[model samples]
Target chain A: MRLCKKTLIWDTSIKWLLVKKMFFILLFTCFIFDAPVAGKDIHVGKDHTIQTIRQGLMKAADYDRLIIHHGVYHEDSLIIDKPIEIIGKQGAIIDAQNHEVDIITIVADSVTVKGLQFRNVGTTFLSEPAAIKISKCKYVTIQNNYIQDCFFGIYVGNSRHCRVINNHAEAAFKEQVSAGNAIHAWKNKHIQIHGNRVHGYRDGIYLEFVNHSSITNNNSYDNLRYGLHFMFSNHDIYQNNTFRNNGAGVAVMFSKKIKMINNHFVHNWGGSSYGLLLKEIVGGEISQNHFEQNTIGIVAEGATRIIISDNRFTSNGTALDMKGNSIDNQVVRNNFLVNTFEVVTNTRYNQNQYMNNYWSGYSGYDLNHDGFGDVPYRPVGLFAKITNSIPAAMIMLHSPLVNLMEMGEKVFPGLTPEGLTDEAPKMKPYAYD
Target chain B: MLKISAVILQNLLRNKAIFGYLVLLCFTGWGMFLYESQPEKAVLSILQIVLLVLPLITLIFTTTYYYHSQEFLFLLLAQPIKRSDIFAGLYIGLAIAFLAVFFIGIGLPVLLFASGMQSLFLLLSGLLLNLVFIAIALLVGVGVHDKSRGIGVTLITWAFFAFIYNGLVIFMMYQLSDYPIENLILVLSFLNPVDIARIMVIMKSEASALLGLSGAVFQDFFGTAKGGVVSILALILWSIIPFWITHKMFRKRDL
Candidate 1:
């Protein structure tokens, strides 16, 4: 009986030992199959085993870092499908040799391109060619790149959480039809485009159907068209950017909840140019902007519930050209200095409000010494009204006839639009930061 | 004629009123340039002076001078001088003296501070304004017999050109607001030398604002080199017509 019991105990112990061994084998196999391998570094240069970027990309695994050394790679249509980081050394150039193809096409998520220079992607009318084209990407970073003379620079489409920072994109094309935008994004979300300088493009920074994007500290100048063009973009914030010498200046159309603050719009003097053109926009905030020497400083057409405050309009042709359809707009606490016509509107009745603004042409006295004029100042001159109706009458500008008509209108208050006066005009200009 | 004009210019240059006018203009021109930070703003202020003060002062001064210089005129008539030569001499003397004062007073400051094509246009228009008003003043002086009536006529003429004609134009524009009066306004602007001068200066300086739709019409007419030449010719005709009438009236007058 004792021998039989000892045999049973040994049997049970061997079964338990078998169970332990099986569990360890299972765990070891799982570790071997599921654990991530450490990413490897692939170098591409004249001396490296992988001499070209295409070879480097081919040999690279997921999450590998491709280090491209300082040399001009005459390559085009280089597609990056794997999630890899491409770090270009100083003087690293990817010359597309005027090819009608994208230089670097990124198609994966979490792909980073840094410190590369792209050149000479030729203009294409049939297809959308870009220097660095990103499609269907997320967490993609395109930073510190220089792209010159390309059709479209850094074109991103259907991207989310992408960053395009510190990029300098320039083109020398004269015609607007031939040139493309420097930084173009379509159907993007959570995009951060900052510290970019774009010049001589059709549009400097353009976004269509983009939401929750922020464009800051960009200097966009001398573009053939708008410096920044927004179409159907919502909840976007653009601040501290300068739009100078652009054809129509910055146009925000079909947008909602846009915040344009602390921007400088200067020298956009042309027949139809505006410092800021807001069309079909709702609930936008434009504050602390400097509009100087523009043909028309701020043009609000079909805009509603826009708060334009604390802006300085100096030496503009028409400081504010509020169209007839614009309603519920508030223009307050602004400084209007030396503009040819202060406020010109197409409507006979004003639905907007202008309050606490300082006008250089305001000749009313502040008898109460309350820093507000006793008399409400009418910004729309009769001649401005005449010019609005009969554009040919603009020849009568600064004429003694116009002056007399203006004086008569002031006394009678009949010709200009009704209720279009600054009720509390400021005695002095606001001190902007 | 040259001898008579030389004497008249010497006699008028010694007048204290002319010197005071020079000082006043100097103070005004320099003060405007110093007060305004922008040369454009200063130009606007100087424009007001040129438009308002210059015409009034020139009209009053010339009419009074014409009346006050009756003895000198009789003295010149008693000599071997032709009546046309005497009239030519008087107009030439007044023109030279006033042009010199205006050039030195406003023109020099403009050249020093705000030297551009715009400022040059301002100076040109201002000089032409002085000549037009001077000729108008001579017409009144030669046509009217009474002293108060001549001065009165000069004042009326200045008022009509400077303020009343503009009021009439505004009235006409308001009455004819429905009609396309752009060409009509352009035609009316030519009739008044003050309007022409004002348009010339303002168009050059404020071309950006004037490049709008209706402004484009004026800009197309005036912004081109052809437009500029036409406006100058119009002003020259304005000056000559009044002076020619004055010369005709003076030649036939029984002095």
Candidate 2:
């Protein structure tokens, strides 16, 4: 009986030894072989082992990086199907040489393209041929790229969680009718586009069907259409972007829950131009914006629940021109300085409320020392009304008789709508950042 | 002609009203700059003052000065000077005094505080307006010998340029609201000196945007070099034609 029990214990010990040996062997194999699986680098240059970028890319496995050297490569559209990093070493140049499609197309997720230059992209009226295009990808980052003479600089389609940073693009096209946007996105979600400078495109940054995006610290100027345009895009925030010398300025249409903060719209002077055009917007906040020397500032049409506060408008055509459905929009705490017309409305009475605004044209003083004007300021002047009715009448604005007529109208309060007045007009301008 | 102009200018400079006008203008310029605290804001206010008050002051002052200088002109007319030289001397003296006022009052402040294309254009516009209105005063002064009638016509002209003309243009726009009368309005704007000055200055300023769509039309009319030349030609015509007509009337006058 004792002998049989000892044999059973020995068998248990041997089973334990076998399990420990297998674990050590597995650990050794992983430590030796798994190092190359997660990390690998292939060089693309004349003297390198990989002669071409395509060869380097083919040799690289998933999660491997392909380093491109400093040389101008005459390549067409190259597709990346693996999760890898394409880092251009020492600012490598990729000339498309009039390619058929995009210069660089990335199809895989978790891919990053950085420190590269793309030039001479193909122009097509049908498909969007961009310098760099990402489609149906996730967790992608495109940064530090310089693109010139391209139809579209950086384009993303059906992508999510993408970051576009520090890219400069200029189209230099005279015919802007056929030019695409500099940074065009469609069907993208959770994208962050920041620190970009774009010029001479149809639109600077255009988004359609994009949501949950943030655009910040970008300078978009001299575009054919809007500096920043959105259609059916929702829950987006754009801040600290300068839109200057654009054709139509920044326009947001059919969007909701948008926050536009601390932007500068400067010198977009055209007959049909506006500093910021809001149409069909719902639940948006436009605050701390600076509109300087623009044709018109804050033209709202068919918008609802928009809060326009703490904005500085200097030398605009009209500070705020509204028509169509006013729908509970609020204009408060803005400085309207040296504008030709303060407020022009399509209708005599609007649903909007104007409160605590400072007008350079205001004649009434703060008599009671309450920091508010003693008399309510009527922003809609006779000239504004006449101009609204007949924009052609603006050419007659220089006649001294118009001043007398305006003065008479102001005293008697007949022609200009009386209800379009700021009740609590501020005596001082708000210090907007 | 030069000696006569110098004498006329010196006599005009001794006049207290011109001194007071200069003081008021300089004070206003300095006060606007002080209150506004920025050159751009100061420039805008100066623009309004130059547009409205400067032309009116120039009109009334020129007409009155011409009437007041009637005896001096008769004395000069008795001398060996040509009729054209006398007329030219009187106009040039008065214009120089007004130009001095403009330079000290508006022009100096603008050059000191706001040095830009816009401010320079506004100053130029103000000076142009001074010349144009003086020419108009000269025409009315020469054509109508009766002091009351001449002053009346001058007042009427000022009223028309300052206020009534714009009113009539607005009425036309209202009547033709259905049509695209922007071009017609542009043509009519060039007819008035004030309108021309306003358009020229406003279009040159970055606030050219303040004209809005009308600005675009104005730009097409006055933005290009060719457009600029056309408007300049028109302005020259406005300035010279009135003076030419007055010169002819002065040369053939019974005075």
Candidate 3:
């Protein structure tokens, strides 16, 4: 009887082991062939409505992809409150049709929106027009979309580490009833704004209360007020952007550690125009940029520790307008060619360095041919020095008598500020592309 | 004729719509003042907006008012007055009434808000620009027989004044870029009323740094006492040339 019971137990155990092996094989095949339900796509537009898509999205689990298809979807505000990827196909246009405050507000993490056109953004007298509003979302990628006639295009407020790349934003101006900015990034950190073209707006890229942002390779032109206007934003880097014929080129006010490189500012001419207006800017490296035919090349008011080197200031009204409080700034190794004035300043007690810049009007000889002037080139004009203390002295700019007076001041060197000299000014113009 | 002039002036002064237009101007002035942190900057911005908007209001108001008072103009024409005298009287009456509204709405505030002699200069410049626009509008209204088409022409002229005229000048400069034509550029600037207004207002600011190239050229030619005289003469020329052309056109037209 014991031998029979043991045999039955052994048989049952063998059967159980075989059943477990079959279950393992089935699980492996399922893992190989089938993805999670979250990976399924929900179509939008045509026969499928956005509301149905949203319902599908709500039912979807994590890592789900919602594919919004082509055609203009006249939907109200779409609130995506889940962690899902809302991908749009080509020719997918989301027209809020001026019904909602925000066209699409994303509250989920890692949302990717591409190949969509947003238009007719609603604007209040106070609130900004936003086509796509993203807040508190992480790792969002917005790329390759055309946004037109919107107040604020793809506004990201209080978001971090988001990539806003390859978008176009056009906006309206001076319409008392409407309010919108093309691309507004407020209080965002570690954001990348790259390769965008923005025009006909109040401001092209407006940064307020932002830090550690990177704006690179954008073309902003014909903006009503400013091309790239920022206030109180710090530690930002902008490189390889072209701001042409804007109201004012770019206004960097009350910001610090902003590194601007390889930018071009050209033909920003008006009564209130400037190529680059730096008011209270601090601790930046403005290098390798080309400023051509602007009213002013660089308008500095109370700026400090700015390293301006390897830049070209050609055919500008004035190359640099240095103010009284602009201290500890280094204007080094720059090319100032055919500007009306190289440097204009008042009350030059600031510890600024006007060294090693090539002045087209430099007359000093370099016998050694080391590309450095044998005698230090003093770019501070006699008229400018005199006008610092006497505001009315500017009237003598083109007078023949004033030329004689300037020659006299040059000989005496009493009216000019002491130690304000370009000690290593280049003998010829610096070669730049 | 005196009664007609008095009626036009009263209608302009007492109208709520005209007062409402003043409110828009006031808001623009206030908005300019609010955005600019410095008082001087604020004054400059307000002056620019005023220069830009005042002309539009003047042109539109004159064109619309002239159309509305077409019966009155016809009745006066049918009476025992010469056509030229009737036209001159109407023009003088419209100019006077518009100037009164302009002085109250734009001129007084510019004077009150701006500092020193700049205020007075801006006030005069604004008035002159306003007159140029009104004269241009009157010329258009008199020339075109169709009222809607006339209004369209006035609006188009305003748009040209506000936006496209500058574009044309810039395009011309671009075309003439390779030439050493600074003197000719100065001549070209005088052709546009907006450019005149811009130069006059900007020459007042501490932006010689920004205006360096243009200012140097302007100062060389127009910056001296001689330059100042030339600028004044240019302003007077801008005011007169448009009126002269308009008057010539008005005289030749049958209406």
TM-score of the first chain alone, every candidate: 0.91, 0.90, 0.85
Candidate number achieving the greatest lDDT relative to the actual structure: 1
Residue-wise C-alpha lDDT for candidate 2, range A280-355, written one tens digit per residue: 9899899999998787888898989999989999888787888858679899999988787788887867688889
Q: Please report the TM-score between candidate 3 and the true structure.
A: 0.59
Clashing pairs in 2: A271-B213, A400-B162, A400-B163, A401-B163
Residue A272's lDDT in candidate 2: 78
**What order do you get sorting by DockQ, best first?**
2, 1, 3
lDDT of each: 0.89, 0.85, 0.74
True contacts kept of each: 0.37, 0.60, 0.09
Residue-level lDDT tens digits of model 1 in A18-67: 99999999999988875554477899988788888999999989988999
Q: Under CAPRI classification, how is model 2 graded? A: acceptable
Per-residue C-alpha lDDT of model 2 across residues B1-255, encoded as one tens digit per residue: 777789989998999889988998998887788778557768877887888889888887888889999998998889888999988888889889999999998888888888997788788888888889899988888788898998888888887877788778777777887887777888888888888887777667654545556447776767776765676677768878888998888999797
- Considering TM-score, where higher is better, how would the candidates rank from best to worst? 2, 1, 3
lDDT of candidate 2? 0.85
| Residue A253 in model 1: lDDT | 96
Best by DockQ: 2
